[model samples]
Target: MNNIEFKHLILTAKYFTKYEPIIDTKTDDIYAYEALSKFEIDNNLISTEDIFRHLHHNNKLFFELEKRNKQLQFESFTENKKLFLNFDADIFVSCEQQSYWELFLNNKKDDIVVEITENGSDDETSANIMRNFSSWLNNKNIETALDDFGQDGSMFSFYMMNGSKYIKIDKSFLRQIELNYNYMHYLKGILTTIRLNGQKSIIEGIETQRDYDLVKELGCDYMQGYFFEELMIIK
Candidate 1:
Protein backbone atom coordinates (compact mmCIF):
# COMPACT_ATOMS: atom_id res chain seq x y z
CA MET A 1 0.00 0.00 0.00
CA ASN A 2 1.23 3.44 -0.91
CA ASN A 3 1.37 6.24 1.63
CA ILE A 4 -1.79 7.81 0.33
CA GLU A 5 -3.65 4.53 0.21
CA PHE A 6 -2.46 3.62 3.66
CA LYS A 7 -3.51 6.97 5.03
CA HIS A 8 -6.93 6.63 3.45
CA LEU A 9 -7.33 3.17 4.92
CA ILE A 10 -6.28 4.42 8.31
CA LEU A 11 -8.88 7.12 8.19
CA THR A 12 -11.63 4.81 6.99
CA ALA A 13 -10.79 1.70 9.02
CA LYS A 14 -12.69 0.79 12.13
CA TYR A 15 -9.90 0.34 14.65
CA PHE A 16 -10.39 -1.13 18.10
CA THR A 17 -8.46 -2.83 20.88
CA LYS A 18 -8.98 -6.34 22.19
CA TYR A 19 -7.49 -7.39 25.48
CA GLU A 20 -6.26 -10.86 26.39
CA PRO A 21 -5.73 -11.44 30.05
CA ILE A 22 -2.36 -12.64 31.31
CA ILE A 23 -2.92 -14.96 34.25
CA ASP A 24 -0.64 -15.42 37.20
CA THR A 25 0.01 -19.13 37.67
CA LYS A 26 0.03 -19.17 41.43
CA THR A 27 -3.12 -17.21 41.98
CA ASP A 28 -4.82 -18.24 38.75
CA ASP A 29 -5.94 -14.64 38.53
CA ILE A 30 -5.54 -11.89 35.98
CA TYR A 31 -2.07 -10.39 36.19
CA ALA A 32 -2.32 -7.98 33.28
CA TYR A 33 -3.95 -7.52 29.88
CA GLU A 34 -2.15 -7.22 26.61
CA ALA A 35 -3.68 -4.67 24.25
CA LEU A 36 -4.09 -6.18 20.82
CA SER A 37 -5.09 -4.03 17.86
CA LYS A 38 -7.83 -5.03 15.45
CA PHE A 39 -8.67 -3.28 12.24
CA GLU A 40 -11.69 -3.68 9.99
CA ILE A 41 -12.26 -1.88 6.75
CA ASP A 42 -15.49 -2.17 4.71
CA ASN A 43 -16.67 -5.05 6.90
CA ASN A 44 -13.54 -7.10 6.39
CA LEU A 45 -10.99 -7.60 9.12
CA ILE A 46 -7.34 -6.92 8.38
CA SER A 47 -4.63 -8.79 10.18
CA THR A 48 -2.41 -6.74 12.45
CA GLU A 49 0.70 -8.19 10.82
CA ASP A 50 -0.42 -7.02 7.38
CA ILE A 51 -1.15 -3.54 8.63
CA PHE A 52 2.24 -3.37 10.35
CA ARG A 53 4.09 -4.71 7.31
CA HIS A 54 2.64 -1.93 5.18
CA LEU A 55 3.19 0.70 7.84
CA HIS A 56 6.86 -0.30 8.05
CA HIS A 57 7.43 1.73 4.90
CA ASN A 58 6.63 4.93 6.78
CA ASN A 59 7.90 5.42 10.31
CA LYS A 60 6.05 8.68 10.92
CA LEU A 61 2.72 7.23 9.84
CA PHE A 62 3.33 4.11 11.89
CA PHE A 63 3.95 6.18 14.98
CA GLU A 64 0.85 8.27 14.35
CA LEU A 65 -1.42 5.29 14.02
CA GLU A 66 0.14 3.65 17.08
CA LYS A 67 -0.31 6.85 19.05
CA ARG A 68 -4.02 6.77 18.33
CA ASN A 69 -4.20 3.06 19.05
CA LYS A 70 -2.52 3.57 22.40
CA GLN A 71 -5.00 6.26 23.27
CA LEU A 72 -7.91 4.00 22.50
CA GLN A 73 -6.40 1.14 24.46
CA PHE A 74 -5.71 3.29 27.46
CA GLU A 75 -9.09 4.96 27.39
CA SER A 76 -11.03 1.75 26.96
CA PHE A 77 -9.22 -0.14 29.70
CA THR A 78 -11.23 0.14 32.91
CA GLU A 79 -9.57 -2.50 35.04
CA ASN A 80 -6.81 -1.62 37.46
CA LYS A 81 -4.55 -4.35 36.11
CA LYS A 82 -1.37 -3.40 34.31
CA LEU A 83 -1.69 -3.07 30.55
CA PHE A 84 0.84 -4.41 28.08
CA LEU A 85 1.22 -2.03 25.14
CA ASN A 86 3.10 -3.15 22.08
CA PHE A 87 5.74 -0.71 20.85
CA ASP A 88 7.46 -1.32 17.56
CA ALA A 89 11.16 -0.51 17.71
CA ASP A 90 11.12 1.21 14.32
CA ILE A 91 8.64 3.84 15.44
CA PHE A 92 11.26 5.62 17.54
CA VAL A 93 12.21 7.76 14.58
CA SER A 94 13.02 11.11 16.13
CA CYS A 95 13.82 12.84 19.37
CA GLU A 96 10.63 14.82 18.87
CA GLN A 97 8.64 11.62 18.72
CA GLN A 98 10.37 10.39 21.85
CA SER A 99 9.47 13.59 23.63
CA TYR A 100 5.88 13.26 22.55
CA TRP A 101 5.63 9.72 23.89
CA GLU A 102 7.50 10.65 27.04
CA LEU A 103 4.85 13.18 27.87
CA PHE A 104 2.08 10.87 26.78
CA LEU A 105 3.25 8.05 29.03
CA ASN A 106 4.54 10.16 31.90
CA ASN A 107 1.88 9.28 34.37
CA LYS A 108 1.30 5.75 33.14
CA LYS A 109 4.64 4.21 33.96
CA ASP A 110 3.33 2.40 36.97
CA ASP A 111 0.52 0.76 35.09
CA ILE A 112 2.06 -0.01 31.74
CA VAL A 113 4.54 -2.40 30.23
CA VAL A 114 5.96 -1.53 26.81
CA GLU A 115 6.29 -4.81 24.93
CA ILE A 116 9.12 -4.57 22.40
CA THR A 117 7.89 -6.16 19.18
CA GLU A 118 10.00 -6.82 16.10
CA ASN A 119 7.73 -7.84 13.28
CA GLY A 120 9.34 -8.20 9.84
CA SER A 121 12.65 -6.52 10.56
CA ASP A 122 14.88 -8.35 12.96
CA ASP A 123 18.30 -7.54 11.62
CA GLU A 124 21.23 -5.92 13.35
CA THR A 125 19.76 -2.48 12.75
CA SER A 126 16.37 -3.47 14.12
CA ALA A 127 17.96 -5.16 17.11
CA ASN A 128 20.01 -2.03 17.84
CA ILE A 129 16.92 0.14 17.59
CA MET A 130 15.08 -2.11 20.02
CA ARG A 131 18.02 -2.13 22.42
CA ASN A 132 18.16 1.64 22.54
CA PHE A 133 14.42 1.98 22.81
CA SER A 134 14.38 -0.60 25.56
CA SER A 135 16.91 1.47 27.44
CA TRP A 136 14.72 4.53 27.03
CA LEU A 137 11.69 2.70 28.35
CA ASN A 138 13.72 1.44 31.29
CA ASN A 139 14.86 4.95 32.05
CA LYS A 140 11.28 6.12 32.09
CA ASN A 141 10.48 3.54 34.79
CA ILE A 142 8.15 1.67 32.47
CA GLU A 143 8.27 -2.11 32.49
CA THR A 144 9.43 -3.74 29.26
CA ALA A 145 8.81 -7.23 27.87
CA LEU A 146 10.61 -9.16 25.16
CA ASP A 147 7.76 -10.40 22.97
CA ASP A 148 7.85 -13.60 20.90
CA PHE A 149 11.28 -14.47 22.24
CA GLY A 150 11.74 -17.64 20.27
CA GLN A 151 9.90 -16.77 17.08
CA ASP A 152 11.60 -16.89 13.71
CA GLY A 153 13.18 -13.53 12.77
CA SER A 154 12.95 -12.41 16.37
CA MET A 155 16.50 -11.64 17.41
CA PHE A 156 17.55 -12.83 20.82
CA SER A 157 19.50 -10.02 22.44
CA PHE A 158 21.05 -11.00 25.73
CA TYR A 159 20.93 -7.39 26.83
CA MET A 160 17.22 -7.21 26.15
CA MET A 161 16.60 -10.65 27.58
CA ASN A 162 18.28 -9.80 30.85
CA GLY A 163 16.92 -6.28 31.16
CA SER A 164 13.31 -7.05 30.47
CA LYS A 165 11.04 -7.52 33.46
CA TYR A 166 9.06 -10.09 31.54
CA ILE A 167 10.06 -12.48 28.76
CA LYS A 168 7.13 -13.93 26.82
CA ILE A 169 7.82 -17.31 25.28
CA ASP A 170 6.17 -17.58 21.88
CA LYS A 171 3.22 -19.88 21.22
CA SER A 172 5.25 -22.16 19.00
CA PHE A 173 7.15 -23.44 22.02
CA LEU A 174 3.95 -25.00 23.30
CA ARG A 175 3.38 -26.77 20.01
CA GLN A 176 6.96 -27.98 19.94
CA ILE A 177 6.65 -29.32 23.45
CA GLU A 178 3.69 -31.41 22.41
CA LEU A 179 5.58 -32.86 19.45
CA ASN A 180 8.81 -33.65 21.25
CA TYR A 181 9.52 -34.22 24.91
CA ASN A 182 12.96 -32.72 24.28
CA TYR A 183 11.29 -29.41 23.55
CA MET A 184 9.72 -29.62 26.98
CA HIS A 185 13.20 -30.08 28.43
CA TYR A 186 14.38 -26.99 26.58
CA LEU A 187 11.43 -24.99 27.93
CA LYS A 188 12.19 -26.10 31.44
CA GLY A 189 15.77 -24.93 31.05
CA ILE A 190 14.62 -21.60 29.65
CA LEU A 191 12.17 -21.11 32.45
CA THR A 192 14.85 -22.03 34.98
CA THR A 193 17.22 -19.45 33.56
CA ILE A 194 14.52 -16.81 33.47
CA ARG A 195 13.73 -17.41 37.13
CA LEU A 196 17.39 -17.34 38.07
CA ASN A 197 17.71 -13.93 36.44
CA GLY A 198 14.86 -12.71 38.65
CA GLN A 199 12.68 -12.12 35.59
CA LYS A 200 9.21 -13.54 35.13
CA SER A 201 8.33 -15.92 32.32
CA ILE A 202 4.98 -15.77 30.51
CA ILE A 203 4.07 -18.71 28.32
CA GLU A 204 1.69 -17.96 25.47
CA GLY A 205 -0.81 -20.20 23.57
CA ILE A 206 -2.34 -22.18 26.40
CA GLU A 207 -5.41 -23.25 24.42
CA THR A 208 -6.46 -26.37 26.30
CA GLN A 209 -6.75 -27.82 29.77
CA ARG A 210 -3.82 -30.08 28.95
CA ASP A 211 -1.80 -27.14 27.72
CA TYR A 212 -2.60 -25.23 30.89
CA ASP A 213 -1.73 -28.19 33.08
CA LEU A 214 1.55 -28.76 31.28
CA VAL A 215 2.59 -25.10 31.34
CA LYS A 216 1.55 -24.74 34.94
CA GLU A 217 3.74 -27.69 35.81
CA LEU A 218 6.63 -26.08 33.92
CA GLY A 219 6.47 -23.25 36.47
CA CYS A 220 5.81 -20.36 34.12
CA ASP A 221 5.12 -17.24 36.11
CA TYR A 222 2.14 -16.35 33.94
CA MET A 223 0.02 -17.93 31.20
CA GLN A 224 -1.93 -16.40 28.34
CA GLY A 225 -4.15 -17.90 25.69
CA TYR A 226 -7.71 -19.02 24.83
CA PHE A 227 -7.75 -21.44 27.74
CA PHE A 228 -7.98 -18.51 30.11
CA GLU A 229 -10.15 -16.13 28.11
CA GLU A 230 -10.68 -15.23 24.50
CA LEU A 231 -9.78 -11.75 23.40
CA MET A 232 -12.46 -9.33 24.62
CA ILE A 233 -13.17 -6.11 22.78
CA ILE A 234 -12.05 -3.17 24.83
CA LYS A 235 -15.22 -1.22 24.15
Candidate 2:
Protein backbone atom coordinates (compact mmCIF):
# COMPACT_ATOMS: atom_id res chain seq x y z
CA MET A 1 0.00 0.00 0.00
CA ASN A 2 1.09 3.56 -0.58
CA ASN A 3 0.70 4.20 3.14
CA ILE A 4 3.26 1.49 4.06
CA GLU A 5 6.58 2.67 5.40
CA PHE A 6 9.50 2.46 2.99
CA LYS A 7 11.65 0.61 5.52
CA HIS A 8 8.96 -2.03 6.01
CA LEU A 9 8.53 -2.48 2.28
CA ILE A 10 12.27 -2.97 1.88
CA LEU A 11 12.22 -5.64 4.59
CA THR A 12 9.35 -7.29 2.74
CA ALA A 13 11.25 -7.29 -0.54
CA LYS A 14 14.15 -9.34 0.84
CA TYR A 15 11.88 -12.34 1.38
CA PHE A 16 10.35 -12.06 -2.09
CA THR A 17 13.15 -10.88 -4.35
CA LYS A 18 14.11 -13.30 -7.13
CA TYR A 19 16.63 -13.65 -9.95
CA GLU A 20 15.77 -14.74 -13.48
CA PRO A 21 18.32 -16.81 -15.34
CA ILE A 22 19.97 -15.54 -18.52
CA ILE A 23 21.59 -18.36 -20.43
CA ASP A 24 24.55 -18.74 -22.72
CA THR A 25 23.04 -20.29 -25.81
CA LYS A 26 26.36 -21.61 -27.06
CA THR A 27 27.21 -23.57 -23.92
CA ASP A 28 23.77 -24.18 -22.34
CA ASP A 29 25.33 -22.89 -19.15
CA ILE A 30 23.94 -20.47 -16.61
CA TYR A 31 25.64 -17.21 -17.47
CA ALA A 32 23.86 -14.95 -15.00
CA TYR A 33 20.67 -14.22 -13.12
CA GLU A 34 19.08 -10.88 -13.81
CA ALA A 35 17.86 -9.73 -10.40
CA LEU A 36 14.13 -9.11 -10.34
CA SER A 37 12.38 -7.51 -7.36
CA LYS A 38 9.12 -8.87 -6.06
CA PHE A 39 7.13 -8.82 -2.83
CA GLU A 40 4.34 -11.10 -1.63
CA ILE A 41 1.76 -8.95 0.08
CA ASP A 42 -1.73 -10.05 1.04
CA ASN A 43 -1.54 -13.24 -1.03
CA ASN A 44 -0.53 -11.25 -4.09
CA LEU A 45 2.84 -10.98 -5.78
CA ILE A 46 3.95 -7.35 -6.10
CA SER A 47 6.42 -6.69 -8.91
CA THR A 48 9.12 -4.07 -9.17
CA GLU A 49 6.89 -2.05 -11.54
CA ASP A 50 4.02 -2.13 -9.06
CA ILE A 51 6.15 -0.96 -6.16
CA PHE A 52 7.69 1.86 -8.18
CA ARG A 53 4.33 3.03 -9.53
CA HIS A 54 2.96 3.43 -6.02
CA LEU A 55 6.13 5.05 -4.75
CA HIS A 56 6.36 7.41 -7.72
CA HIS A 57 5.47 10.46 -5.65
CA ASN A 58 8.15 9.75 -3.06
CA ASN A 59 11.66 10.24 -4.42
CA LYS A 60 13.48 9.51 -1.18
CA LEU A 61 11.59 6.24 -0.69
CA PHE A 62 12.25 5.25 -4.31
CA PHE A 63 15.99 5.73 -3.85
CA GLU A 64 16.00 3.83 -0.57
CA LEU A 65 14.17 0.87 -2.10
CA GLU A 66 16.76 0.68 -4.91
CA LYS A 67 19.67 0.78 -2.47
CA ARG A 68 18.14 -2.01 -0.42
CA ASN A 69 17.61 -4.13 -3.54
CA LYS A 70 21.30 -3.90 -4.43
CA GLN A 71 22.40 -4.66 -0.87
CA LEU A 72 20.21 -7.73 -0.54
CA GLN A 73 21.27 -9.10 -3.93
CA PHE A 74 24.94 -8.54 -3.24
CA GLU A 75 24.86 -10.26 0.16
CA SER A 76 23.23 -13.40 -1.26
CA PHE A 77 25.07 -13.62 -4.59
CA THR A 78 27.15 -16.73 -5.34
CA GLU A 79 30.25 -17.03 -7.48
CA ASN A 80 28.93 -19.55 -9.95
CA LYS A 81 26.63 -17.20 -11.85
CA LYS A 82 27.24 -13.60 -12.66
CA LEU A 83 25.00 -11.11 -10.82
CA PHE A 84 23.31 -8.80 -13.34
CA LEU A 85 22.06 -5.54 -11.84
CA ASN A 86 20.32 -2.80 -13.85
CA PHE A 87 20.48 0.89 -13.18
CA ASP A 88 20.25 4.07 -15.20
CA ALA A 89 23.50 5.60 -16.40
CA ASP A 90 22.95 8.68 -14.24
CA ILE A 91 22.71 6.69 -11.01
CA PHE A 92 26.47 6.21 -11.00
CA VAL A 93 27.00 9.98 -10.76
CA SER A 94 25.56 9.92 -7.26
CA CYS A 95 28.15 9.97 -4.50
CA GLU A 96 26.16 7.64 -2.28
CA GLN A 97 25.29 5.12 -4.98
CA GLN A 98 28.85 5.13 -6.30
CA SER A 99 30.23 4.39 -2.85
CA TYR A 100 27.81 1.51 -2.37
CA TRP A 101 28.59 0.11 -5.82
CA GLU A 102 32.34 0.38 -5.28
CA LEU A 103 32.03 -1.52 -2.03
CA PHE A 104 30.27 -4.36 -3.79
CA LEU A 105 32.91 -4.46 -6.52
CA ASN A 106 35.59 -4.60 -3.86
CA ASN A 107 34.08 -7.72 -2.32
CA LYS A 108 33.04 -9.54 -5.49
CA LYS A 109 35.53 -8.66 -8.18
CA ASP A 110 34.14 -11.08 -10.74
CA ASP A 111 30.89 -12.17 -12.39
CA ILE A 112 29.09 -8.88 -11.93
CA VAL A 113 27.55 -7.03 -14.85
CA VAL A 114 26.06 -3.61 -14.23
CA GLU A 115 23.40 -3.19 -16.88
CA ILE A 116 22.79 0.41 -17.94
CA THR A 117 19.08 0.60 -18.57
CA GLU A 118 17.10 3.17 -20.53
CA ASN A 119 18.07 6.40 -18.90
CA GLY A 120 16.31 9.73 -19.45
CA SER A 121 18.82 10.91 -22.03
CA ASP A 122 22.18 10.20 -23.61
CA ASP A 123 23.71 13.62 -23.56
CA GLU A 124 27.43 14.12 -23.53
CA THR A 125 27.55 14.63 -19.80
CA SER A 126 25.67 11.47 -18.74
CA ALA A 127 27.24 9.42 -21.54
CA ASN A 128 30.76 10.58 -20.68
CA ILE A 129 30.23 9.96 -16.99
CA MET A 130 28.96 6.45 -17.59
CA ARG A 131 31.87 5.71 -19.94
CA ASN A 132 34.33 6.81 -17.28
CA PHE A 133 32.64 4.84 -14.51
CA SER A 134 32.52 1.82 -16.79
CA SER A 135 36.27 2.08 -17.29
CA TRP A 136 36.75 2.25 -13.54
CA LEU A 137 34.57 -0.80 -13.05
CA ASN A 138 36.54 -2.63 -15.76
CA ASN A 139 39.79 -2.19 -13.89
CA LYS A 140 38.08 -3.74 -10.84
CA ASN A 141 36.84 -6.70 -12.96
CA ILE A 142 33.21 -5.53 -12.78
CA GLU A 143 31.89 -5.43 -16.35
CA THR A 144 29.21 -3.17 -17.77
CA ALA A 145 26.52 -4.08 -20.27
CA LEU A 146 24.42 -1.69 -22.33
CA ASP A 147 20.81 -2.75 -21.87
CA ASP A 148 17.85 -2.31 -24.23
CA PHE A 149 19.99 -1.22 -27.13
CA GLY A 150 17.98 0.66 -29.81
CA GLN A 151 14.71 0.44 -27.88
CA ASP A 152 14.20 4.20 -27.96
CA GLY A 153 15.94 7.36 -28.97
CA SER A 154 17.91 7.63 -25.75
CA MET A 155 18.81 3.97 -25.88
CA PHE A 156 19.70 4.12 -29.57
CA SER A 157 22.10 6.90 -28.76
CA PHE A 158 24.05 4.41 -26.67
CA TYR A 159 24.27 1.94 -29.55
CA MET A 160 27.46 3.57 -30.81
CA MET A 161 29.03 3.94 -27.39
CA ASN A 162 32.26 1.96 -27.41
CA GLY A 163 32.75 1.58 -23.70
CA SER A 164 30.53 -1.41 -23.04
CA LYS A 165 31.89 -4.95 -23.15
CA TYR A 166 28.42 -6.46 -23.54
CA ILE A 167 25.44 -5.23 -25.57
CA LYS A 168 21.88 -6.55 -25.19
CA ILE A 169 19.99 -6.15 -28.44
CA ASP A 170 16.53 -4.77 -27.75
CA LYS A 171 13.71 -7.29 -28.08
CA SER A 172 11.65 -4.94 -30.22
CA PHE A 173 14.18 -5.32 -32.99
CA LEU A 174 13.73 -9.08 -33.03
CA ARG A 175 9.99 -9.34 -32.41
CA GLN A 176 9.14 -9.61 -36.11
CA ILE A 177 12.51 -10.21 -37.66
CA GLU A 178 11.97 -13.90 -38.26
CA LEU A 179 8.84 -13.17 -40.27
CA ASN A 180 10.27 -10.39 -42.37
CA TYR A 181 13.13 -10.93 -44.75
CA ASN A 182 14.25 -7.32 -44.64
CA TYR A 183 14.13 -7.29 -40.86
CA MET A 184 16.14 -10.49 -40.71
CA HIS A 185 18.83 -9.08 -42.91
CA TYR A 186 18.86 -5.84 -40.95
CA LEU A 187 19.31 -7.72 -37.68
CA LYS A 188 22.01 -9.87 -39.24
CA GLY A 189 23.89 -6.74 -40.19
CA ILE A 190 23.59 -5.37 -36.67
CA LEU A 191 24.90 -8.54 -35.07
CA THR A 192 27.76 -8.70 -37.55
CA THR A 193 28.67 -5.13 -36.70
CA ILE A 194 28.67 -5.95 -33.00
CA ARG A 195 30.91 -8.94 -33.56
CA LEU A 196 33.25 -6.89 -35.66
CA ASN A 197 33.50 -4.42 -32.80
CA GLY A 198 34.76 -7.24 -30.58
CA GLN A 199 31.83 -6.94 -28.15
CA LYS A 200 29.65 -9.92 -27.33
CA SER A 201 25.96 -9.72 -28.19
CA ILE A 202 23.00 -10.87 -26.07
CA ILE A 203 20.01 -11.20 -28.35
CA GLU A 204 16.83 -10.91 -26.28
CA GLY A 205 13.38 -12.40 -27.04
CA ILE A 206 14.22 -15.65 -28.76
CA GLU A 207 10.86 -17.36 -28.22
CA THR A 208 10.87 -19.97 -30.96
CA GLN A 209 13.10 -22.58 -32.53
CA ARG A 210 13.33 -20.52 -35.70
CA ASP A 211 14.45 -17.53 -33.67
CA TYR A 212 17.10 -19.55 -31.89
CA ASP A 213 18.43 -21.01 -35.14
CA LEU A 214 18.41 -17.61 -36.76
CA VAL A 215 20.47 -16.03 -34.00
CA LYS A 216 22.83 -18.97 -34.08
CA GLU A 217 23.46 -18.14 -37.72
CA LEU A 218 24.04 -14.51 -36.83
CA GLY A 219 26.62 -15.52 -34.26
CA CYS A 220 24.69 -14.28 -31.21
CA ASP A 221 26.82 -14.70 -28.14
CA TYR A 222 23.84 -15.16 -25.81
CA MET A 223 20.07 -15.58 -26.03
CA GLN A 224 17.06 -15.32 -23.69
CA GLY A 225 13.25 -15.46 -23.70
CA TYR A 226 10.50 -18.13 -23.69
CA PHE A 227 12.70 -20.53 -25.62
CA PHE A 228 14.99 -20.68 -22.62
CA GLU A 229 12.36 -19.95 -19.99
CA GLU A 230 12.21 -23.61 -18.89
CA LEU A 231 15.95 -23.47 -18.31
CA MET A 232 15.61 -21.26 -15.27
CA ILE A 233 18.79 -21.90 -13.30
CA ILE A 234 18.46 -19.13 -10.70
CA LYS A 235 16.42 -21.22 -8.24
| Highest-scoring model, TM-score | 1
Off by over 4 Å in 2: 1-7, 53-59, 120-141, 158-160, 233-235
TM-score of each: 0.95, 0.80
Cα deviation in Å at residue 113, candidate 1? 0.6
Error of 1 at 225 (Å): 0.4
Candidate 2 structure quality by residue, lDDT tens digits, 1-235: 4456555855664345466677687886778777766766556777766766666556456667777777777666655778888864444566786787688667765667888764455677666766667666767677778887767575354433466788888777777664566787888787887889998889887788887787777778888777777755342
Instruction: Report the lDDT of model 1 for residue 226.
Output: 86
List model 1 lDDT by residue over 63-127, tens digit each: 87888878888988999899999988777758988988998888788889989888567677777
Give candidate 1 misplaced runs (Cα > 4 Å).
Answer: 230-233
Backbone N/Cα/C clashes per model? 0, 0
Error of 1 at 104 (Å): 1.4
Model 1 RMSD in angstroms: 1.5
- Weakest lDDT window of 10 consecutive positions for candidate 2: 152-161
Q: What is the lDDT of candidate 2?
A: 0.70
